[model samples]
Target chain A: MSKQAPVIAIDAMGGDHGPEVTVPAALDCLRQYPQLQLILVGQDAVLRESLAAHGRSDHPRLRIHHASEVVAMDDLPSRALRNKRDSSMRVALNLVRDGEADACVSAGNTGALMATARFVLKTIPGIDRPAIIVTLPAANGCTHILDMGANVDCSAEHLYQFAVMGYELVRAVENVDSPRVGLLNIGEEEIKGNEQVKQAARLLSSSYLNFIGYVEGDDIFTGQVDIVVTDGFVGNVALKTIEGLARLLGQALREGFQKNLYARLVGLMALPVLRGFKQRFDPRRYNGATLLGLQGIVIKSHGNADRAAFANAIRMALLEIDKAVPERIGERVATIFANGAGIHEDAPHTTRMNRA
Target chain B: MSKQAPVIAIDAMGGDHGPEVTVPAALDCLRQYPQLQLILVGQDAVLRESLAAHGRSDHPRLRIHHASEVVAMDDLPSRALRNKRDSSMRVALNLVRDGEADACVSAGNTGALMATARFVLKTIPGIDRPAIIVTLPAANGCTHILDMGANVDCSAEHLYQFAVMGYELVRAVENVDSPRVGLLNIGEEEIKGNEQVKQAARLLSSSYLNFIGYVEGDDIFTGQVDIVVTDGFVGNVALKTIEGLARLLGQALREGFQKNLYARLVGLMALPVLRGFKQRFDPRRYNGATLLGLQGIVIKSHGNADRAAFANAIRMALLEIDKAVPERIGERVATIFANGAGIHEDAPHTTRMNRA
Candidate 1:
């Protein structure tokens, strides 16, 4: 591997399909981006067998990092953190922490991934807790939303930090000068949400970030804002709800076309148009959800992600690595704290670092 | 009007188009249901003019109830409650309170409508606060979810109450003997959500209701559960996100069909199939959201509802009246309290009635 190549550690034993999906996705990434190097972490025998099947077991850009234990999809976060230190998920995260890889990508149990990532990599200074931010296709382009289920409960200060991190991510990755940020609330009215959201809105409004007041859930798809900030609980539900709706619509459309012979004929003729429309809002194209505020880049692919989706997640990690996202986020957060513009005076001094 | 006919008070000056939509919708409902009576509440002259335009000025089953003031769509809930005493929404709600109308339907500001209805009708006995429940199209049939936006901060007891209310509503309206109830959470695991959801899950597990354990957002459309209970904030966001996704898909489909002449021809040929799919998930068909736990039936129509949508809201009110939803919900809560099945021991004794 070239010395300047960006190295990504992959959890080969993660996700439903394990090495079957991750190994192929890693190879695809390596083929697509010649400079990209990947370390596939999994059981040595299984990794060798899977790679040998692909006819390039000795590929220069790929290597195997053997891990004895594999965290089960249903494992508790605390249990995984405590007992599965040698798990593939933990070893991949350890690679990032030890500077062996520029970033890491995993399609694993979300709670366990978060726990292991937080434990091994730690959070960036000035960020209370790491958040999961994902880009969702929208009307105009796409919108990025955060806290997609890392923390169940969050404070106003934590929300404010998410806004800053989301804004910085969009700016760095999307190449926008100043991203429009919005607090996701039930309504656009000033007095709409619970105390935390209302307080966060106040904090955001006082900040120098391009803080548009409040946006409802619809605004995420309307493409009226660039980054939507919300607590983990709401964000997670909204994301899953979106997923469910998309599946429902897709199924309904398929059923509609197969209703009769004439409709099937028309569906065949309309294939290109339908495919183009589907491509525009394809979930696989928008697969990776970055765990932000961590000391190094960590991308979480959906556990059921296909090869294309997993590759997209690797692409996201590559982009974050190329953009130096963590360094930029740490600097931006430090600057915000030093300036004391958005920081609340009464904001809790305790962060996850101190608490842990 | 027949002696047994249900009387519905309509807020004629509510919604975006006011009487332009509500007056026609009222006429439509009256025409459809021979035993239905409607009182159009609004500015006297404007409503009279609207009725005259619809050639229903002398309809026996329809009458005008003059409300002197109008609540602006953006008015704060407190302001609408304090100042708009004789506003169309308030007057219509008052008609329900006075037993002059069996129910009231309003396509006005949500917060104002909620605040005014709570004040005018009060919550049913054993119920603390009112909640908004609406049915959304799902895979097999439909699923009812609450509280869509009435109570932002909810306790475990409040969620338990919502579950009971939703269960009763579905049983009465949908004719389902025992509706499956699921608590909306970030994950389906026992340790997924915050303290409130966890406590609520325990409460539900011990209750007589058909309590399925926790479900994620996608389950709402999967039709795996009959009723999904969540706090106002998450429910509202999820519902709006669904709406947004629906709109986005609709637009994308339209644009896809209009892409080229060939595509347009295929769209024309496939129009029937597309229309069938659209009709199955039409928002207008699911237009009404009942304010559950109120002493009287109060249905809130979408603020921007067209005539068809407004008429659907009226139809929902009629169905609720036929089923005596408010009375059934009151009885259900009374029985739950009597049995002492789900009520938490340390649940706050202070209800919204005392606080309000």
Candidate 2:
């Protein structure tokens, strides 16, 4: 909307579809915003071909950063970092580090992207392990959940850090001033889950976060809490389960509409409203995946993301830029650690106290 | 359809709704299967009231097993078992132990149910810890995922037991011979998850199970594997997440159909087909929760399950009784530990080797 728009560096060689989807998406973002500055990072020849094919070569603010290689989806994080020095993902991360762009966006290998961001930009001050934040489309707006697959085995300290970081994210994007944070567990009672969740609940409660009591799986979409935090393993499963079920239900709706001529007519008439309702759950509008705890902002788009999804990722990056979330999160975690709140405690110890 | 149906003991004083839903559901089950015998276990006065009001007191096969106490949903597992001696859940478990019923069904407190079953019936011959098996509605049919909140912290041996037990379940119910089993993880690669998942993967590969390597959360509903094994902490979250998403999608669909007159007409015409499709995804039709690795079959229905859901749970109990899943699973686990297959190697040592 403004002339001084933010610039986002995109890894054109990353993701399942790569430049095929990324180039068109970048063009769409530019078309919509009119002022968006995009620095496309990828191989020179391929980038040129894709840009020309989209009739986007003559765009004023569009530029290309020539990087020669790519990190494959299956490439191990550590090995890829050591081996692929000039990869597009790495170069895009460098742009953010060097202050050439406000943020970096990629739909590439999630592990590789997270590793590269941490390796290059490093963790922000007081943030221990960076997390992946997923914004789920809920009946009452989108619910932001964190640590979706970044760190698998987390300490109580790590989870505390994730909650602090996630709280800031929900406030920043959803604009909820006092975001209610819930620890994901098997039951609503504090004592009803494994040691880790109980410990995390204790840490969250003791911190400055507006911590609600333990929340079960069903609570995630109930809008009972604004932010839900967990270890990546549980969070990842929750995210995937939601996606799979949404797809399943959508298919069922289609079949239902196709059953009879009356249904077909009804389906045609209801198409606009159904589309509107579905747009709320489209996932494209909510596809931006944030790598929390990083020194800078990094957003990972879905691998099969289309133009609309990628644009949304750009919009998310802009929101983060506006909120200064990473810095605020860093300050909060530092304050907690400085106070020496609930550290040097075992999982069971925390669990017992929290359950009490 | 048969002349002489199997007998199932019901814990009427269980679940959030208790006799309010359970008694009516039992009556419905008897109606659906005229030959089925019901052994209702609860306080005599309340059961009599519900039965009389429902006009089902005249049936000759309807029997009552009086139980004075009930298991509160939030009671600690250990405390509840030691203190609530005559609880309905405990009495129900005793029926299975006393051989008075072929199988028992409860919608009681899960922890208490698990603790009582373990205490009374004991673990299957060679199993370390009994798992909780719940079927997930998948694209092809359904996949039985084990340890869906029974055993929180699992060992390599525990997962090995779950796989064997889960294999027997799918083979008996789904009729899939040599069912494919997958260890739930963050990625599909052999080395893509946390320490526990990796160790379980290694042991599963060496065992007699049809180990199909690692599976991510998304793959759970694709019907790519017949069984998915994970620790209870993760499995619980996965199951609840799926449940939440299913309910959320259903709500969204209903809301979408009610937007206007056109949409309402579409909804009207699509009702039959939508209902049919929903029947496929309904948790009620698949409402049986098996307490795996037990000496006898004990199924836990949903706490708020209505007549239809409760009937499905009873139906599942009958099928398991006929298949003799308990006896088969016990034999499989016994063979693994008897041969000293993965147990002799030591789990920690395997974990260290795999990590290195």
Extract clashing residue pairs from model 1.
none
> What tens digits encode model 1's per-residue C-alpha lDDT throughout A250-356?
99999999988988988898899999999999999999999998888899999999999999999999998888888788778878787554433222223222222
* Per-residue lDDT over B161-245 for candidate 2, one digit per residue giving the tens place of the 0 to 100 score: 7888899888888777789999888862423787777888898899788999988787787878889999888888888878777
Compared with the true structure, what per-residue lDDT tens digits does model 1 show for residues B121-223? 8777777778899999999899999999888999999999999999999999899899899999997253489999999999999989999999999999999
Q: Name the TM-score of candidate 1.
A: 0.94
In angstroms, the error of model 1 at B52 is 1.7
The local distance difference test score of each candidate is 0.88, 0.80
Recovered native contacts, candidate 1: 0.76
Relative to the real complex, the DockQ score for model 1 comes to 0.62
Q: In candidate 2, which residue ranges exceed 4 Å CA deviation?
A: A1-5, A188-191, A259-263, A338-356, B1-5, B188-191, B339-356
